[model samples]
Target chain A: MKKKFNLPVRQLATVGAFALFLLLGNFLMAKKIIGLYYTKVLMVAAINMILAVSLNIATGFLGQLPLGSAGFMAVGAYTSAIIMRKVTFVSPALAFPVCIIIGGLAAALCGFIIGLPALRLKGDYIAIITLGFAEIIRIVILNIDSALGITLTYGASNLKNIPKTTTFTNAFIWVFIVCYLVSALMKSRHGRAILSIRDNEIAAESCGINLTYYKTMAFIVYAFFTGIGGALYAGYLGILNPSGFSFAKSIDILVMVVLGGMGSMTGSVISAAVLTIVPEILHAFSDYRMIVYSLLLIVVMIFRPAGLMGNKEFSMDMLTGLFKKKAKGERSKK
Target chain B: MSTFSLIIKQIINGLQLGSIFALVAVGYSMVYGIIRLLNFAHCDIIMVGAYIAWFFMTNFANMPIIAVVASILGCTLLGVTIEKVAYKPLRSSPRISLLITAIGISYLLENTAQLVLGAAAKKVPGFFTAETIRIGQVTVSTASLVTIAVLAVSMVLLTLLVQKTKLGRAMRAVSEDAETAQLMGTNINGTISFTFAVGSALAGIGSVLYCCAYPQVSPTMGSMLGLKAFVAAVLGGIGSIPGAMIGGFMIGLTEVFVSAIGLSTWKDAVVFLILIIILLVKPSGILGKTVSEKV
Candidate 1:
């Protein structure tokens, strides 16, 4: 009875903390204590964190490399942007959330269709097939305007004039939800089956986990979040170009997942923030920075193959442990 | 121009493009057969080879032959060095790690090239004489004929090398089972290096041909070309030589035909669509063996 009473208190406190962070951040931006430029960077970082975390579900937990994430993002982005364009009758507050949902659903549907045939192949073949699918999507989007003889996407010209409804507060709320749902899922029985599949596919199959169902579930979930992230990106930018979603962009998100410990959500968030911020700060050494970044990736893989956190999440215990003399022991061992 | 001549001209263009793709795809197939790596950096080797050839030919201006040889040698050396430095220590690690390392290397090369050479596309002077061979309305360049001829020679030589050589036996044995091959006294490191050497050399040849056909060298030229060649390799059943050649030609023709029929913008889309269809129908590809996994 005491533990049950504590649970609600703890949940209320967490909600209070989230609310505090959101309001504080907004106040700082309003007063210009935090510049608009930095605010934009923070929002971009939040979106990237969402992308990295979503991709981790498949690449880290499910153990598949589908390189068409940018394509799914494109689907979500264009869908949401187009829907928002059509629904000028509704209030911005009412229409924004609905558009994001529709965008995510569209991408989720795409993920299901593509996942069926693409997942039949294993490892490198799956990677290549997904890449093919991404390329096809990009090309279709690029040529669709001319093919249809209409201005649906505006094709290479870029879709513009969508209202910028994704603020920092709203974006972080979505990020919080995505992170929470992923953690909750991974803690459930279904998440155990997904983890089992990643650990050993053949063994998981023998154990009566329907391989296709779980694999598709991971993919669908991944697609939905990616779409939500993309929807935010479209709203933030106020423009949507097919060129924005490319193979290189997919690799950029993958780099974040790799730089972080793939199986760890906190690692994805921290690395995503650092990567987004650092690049913006080092705008002068742009070309040389990429050289350094690639070298970092290589050296990191060689020296610490599992990544910075090595599949471990950061927790309060970790911080408290550092204060204790027992900190000499690797906390990862637990 | 009549319709028949335009079609014939397009066929010739396809053949020339296809031959270059075949050379690169063979390289991809050979390396993948042994290491099971996509070898993402292989494409950058082609770009480097083009740059090296451009450097030599521009400085020397008289001996195009020396430029070709240097490009090939540079590619081979670079390929071997990358394998030794980046890949060697990770042999026992997970495949995903190896894959990530490959991606890092690819980015490294492309970025370094961009930093050093700048991102502007360089126009390569015609290595061959600007002479055209024409019969009726189909006019083909001398370079196109040379590319086709070189492809035929390379295929025959490569087929003979893989089928009849001692190194070939070692390669076959290793790809089949590395531990067994080592137990049977094959030098695993040497065999892998040799595979990289030959594959990079093919990429070098492809670079020279690509420069001839496209007549431009840029830092990112290899990526698009490499991606297509990789697609061809997969379409042909990755590890098979004949399959790579056939897949390259098929891809080249399909691209040409798609564009020729007035869907020029949809060429890339059509190519990927075909790959998806074929992969779905036959997961192992047209000529790939469907090896059942053993628990």
Candidate 2:
């Protein structure tokens, strides 16, 4: 019988290295040498990571191509912002957690509503419905404030003046927490069910899996994180606009998921970081950036149809094995 | 205007708008029927067609008919080329891959048009001006009548092509089952290209009619119209040509009615609301047939 594997010393070093890099980034931002501009960019990247990974759960893991992530995010953003704006007496520290949870719940509720009918549909139909739902949500939000006679100031102009709560530290911490939580979830029993469904819903059902229950669970959970991500985004940007969460934004998030290996947590993180940073670096080609981005996606799909990472996970096995060999050699020398 | 006259005016407006949608929806429905891929680029094709017409009309103003003919032919050729280049190679790829490619093509076309044409909206020359006809207290613009007539002729021609021609038969055969049609000696590539050509040619006509009625053109104009036409196609039953025609009118009338009822802000929302409700109630769409897969 095979024994359980242990993490290698080298794999531990990589994680330690990444953690240190994040720490250094935070330190630099706090010290003011790197400038707040880059820090803001990093925050955007963190929010995008949260969105892309959460969406990967549904589209990549659950095998449902939901184009309504933007709609759900919009719901979460507006709900959290309204809560934060109305409950102004609460401490910012206390409100932060409340906002994230509220955002998540609002998004999950929207997801439940959208998913009830949408989960039953498949492929292009799901995509179209979700796309329509997002547009409807945008339009509804545009008219919502006016309908209530509240002067509906939050469409193209953006929702302003809630609180500036997100900092480099908070955003970095949230990024780590989200990445770890999503990765752990994906390694769990529920994660296995998601993968099974993605492989073949019919076969998975034949294996006695309740397709609707599990699929809805994934959908809800995905919506929850996406909502939190939206909250983080609203807080970081200090403004919320309907235009900010358009179909184009949804497409951008989808690009990250697609570019990252769809089912790979590591792939999501890397792609999110790269896609977020690459455009800023190519600022010289402002007009051509999207054109290049679109072409890159097309080329990548043509060359690597499975995506950049293709369901592979980060493993400590090889690193641990090498570390063990090195330890043995050192002991022999002693 | 009298209430009855107002109603007639609105109905005529709806018909004019619906016919444009029907033109674009036919391309969307045909492409979706054959490949099951919602060619997101189809919208941009309409934009390109409008731009082509604009370029010809602005530069070669002396020969207006030749310019119109050239724009339609240019757009048709462009559509066929896109199919040959981007779509055909990815035929066997996953739906998501093809979807991304369609989006890529869409962005490529839109951005290219923006770079070439500039971001500002352009004014297209009016095909007819200073002419109105009145009937029973209702006055209709000449352009509106022309739009209705052009759409009617386009529909009739499309119906004949789909129902009567040998190529149309081949298109139907391939759409039903590509491999089976190939086995039956149909040139799959040729049929698909022809489908794109016909669909794009119609888009060209739609663009001319749209520019005439609206009198404005922009690179991004096709995005909203394309999405609306897609909704219309789905409403009428995707893959059914007659269904697209009916769906187009329904969407146009609904939009007008929503705006007329003092819910101007909710016009876009109403269109989508209708789509969601339809999809929830009838997954195959209004006129679409459900095809069960044999395991």
Candidate 3:
């Protein structure tokens, strides 16, 4: 009877934490503590957080360096933006979330197509191929409207007047949901298998873990969120340009993941926020910002290649251990 | 011009473009061969070379040959410095880290250029006198002919340097197994630095040729050019010398043909598409050995 009453402790705790977060978020927004400028900044930060965490799934966990997250994002952004524009019957609020999901699916499809052939190769080949895919995506988007004789993406001129359905609250909710889902996936049996593959591909194969299936799965999931982030980005900006989703954008996301610690979800989230905010804070130093970013990347890789968090994750165990140690110290002093 | 003359002109243009790509691609291939790094910054050596040449031409002398030599020396120094300062410490780290550091170095070079020189594109002074040669039916640009001549001469010189020189043997040994090379009393650092120097010198000459053809220099100019050259390197099987040259010409020809077919806007896409197809269909690339990894 006691064992039955024990319940799923972790799940219960997660739900409670989520509820608390919503309450706190509501209070902050209601009180206007996070001003308009901060809200906009936070929204961008949240989108980056989603991108970084999702990219972590591939580069951090699966140990594959995919340089095409922006390509997937562009696909999603265009898909969602077009859907929102064309589907006049549906309400903007309802259509927005649905469009984001559809956009994610579109990106996932692209990921499946690109990943099949790309993941077959190892190391830098995957990087270059993925990079090629990204450039192709950007170029196609840039030239597709001209070729097709339609204003789908408006070509290089870009799409203007996208319905602004993405708000701070909605973006925040999505970021939390994505972070939760990714972390949950990372903790599952499938996550362990993925980690094993990263640790040693040959060993993982010998142990009967299917490489192709898992690699594609990771790529697909990563692409899905990248697409969602893109859809949200489109709504936030109220415009879309192929140039906005270039190889530079992909590198920016990569920098976040690399800075945060590839294997740590929390690290990615924190780094994403910091990186996004740092530029805005240092707006006066705009020209030097890229120089600083480049120097930081080189310095970090040289000194601490593992990144800020390394492979260690934040958990209740760490907190409890700290509290227990403090209590024991006090007790001993007494 | 007649259609046959037009075709000849396009082929000349392709050869000129191809020569630049081959020079840059050789640098990319050599670096990748030795360090197993993509060296994302390798292409920026061209930009650095171009700027150096431009400075020499505008501020000092309009002497093309001296500018070319000075730019080549400048790029060699920059490449060696980057290898020593940024990449050397992360040599034993993960390949991804090295790759990211290379990207960092690339960004650093580009941003520095943007800051110092401004972001606008500057016109490069013509290296050679504007002259045209007429055949029986077709006219050819002297610049294109000179580019091809320079490419041929450089290829011959580079081949001899790699095949016959003691330093070339050290580079080959380091590429094969650095640990073994070190055991055999090779100065590994010197060998790697030499490789960077030679590769960057080629990029320097490539910059001079590219500037002669296009006559424009910008902070971000190296990016697209570098990407194309890197694609050429990969298409030719990444680690092979002759493969890079062949791949460079193939890319150049493909781009010219694509534009000739009136898909000028899609030329970049087509180049990237070719890279994807080549990677998928033949990962080892043409002229490359299919060496499978063993546990």
Query: Which 10-residue span in candidate 1 chain A carries the lowest summed lDDT?
Result: A1-10
Per model, kept true contacts as a fraction are: 0.65, 0.66, 0.83
Q: Which model, 1 or 2, shows the larger lDDT?
A: 1
Q: On residues A1-334, what C-alpha lDDT tens digit does candidate 3 reach at each position?
A: 1122233786688678877876786688789997788778988998999999999999999988989999999999999999998888978898999999999999999999899888888778778778888889999999988898987889878798889999877898899889889988988988998999899999999999999999889889999999999999988988998889988899899999999998999899999999999888888998788898889899889888889899777666556677878998999999
- On DockQ, the candidate that comes out on top is 3
- Per-residue lDDT tens digits for candidate 1, residues B1-295, read 8888877888888988899989999998988889888898999999999999999888877888988999999999999999999998888977777877887898899989998999999887778766688876688888888999999999999889889999988888888888899999999999999999999999999999998899889998888788788889888988899999998999898888888889998988888887788878886767889877867
Question: Model 3, which residues run further than 4 Å from truth?
Answer: A1-7, A329-334
**What are the per-residue Cα lDDT tens digits for candidate 3 across B1-295?**
7899899999998989999999999999999999988888988889999999888777655567788889989999999999999888887887888898999999999999999999999987777676788878988888899998998898899888888999988998998889999999999989998999999989999988888889889989898899899899989987788899899999998999899999999998999999888887898879888877857
Mark the 10 consecutive residues where model 2 chain B has the least summed lDDT: B123-132
Interface RMSD, all candidates in order, equals 1.5, 1.4, 0.9
List DockQ, one per candidate, in order.
0.69, 0.65, 0.82
State which candidate has the highest lDDT.
3
TM-score of chain B of each: 0.97, 0.96, 0.97
Off by over 4 Å in 1: A1-10, A320-334, B135-137
Evaluate model 2: give its lDDT.
Answer: 0.83
DockQ of 1: 0.69
Clashing pairs for predicted structure model 3, backbone only: none
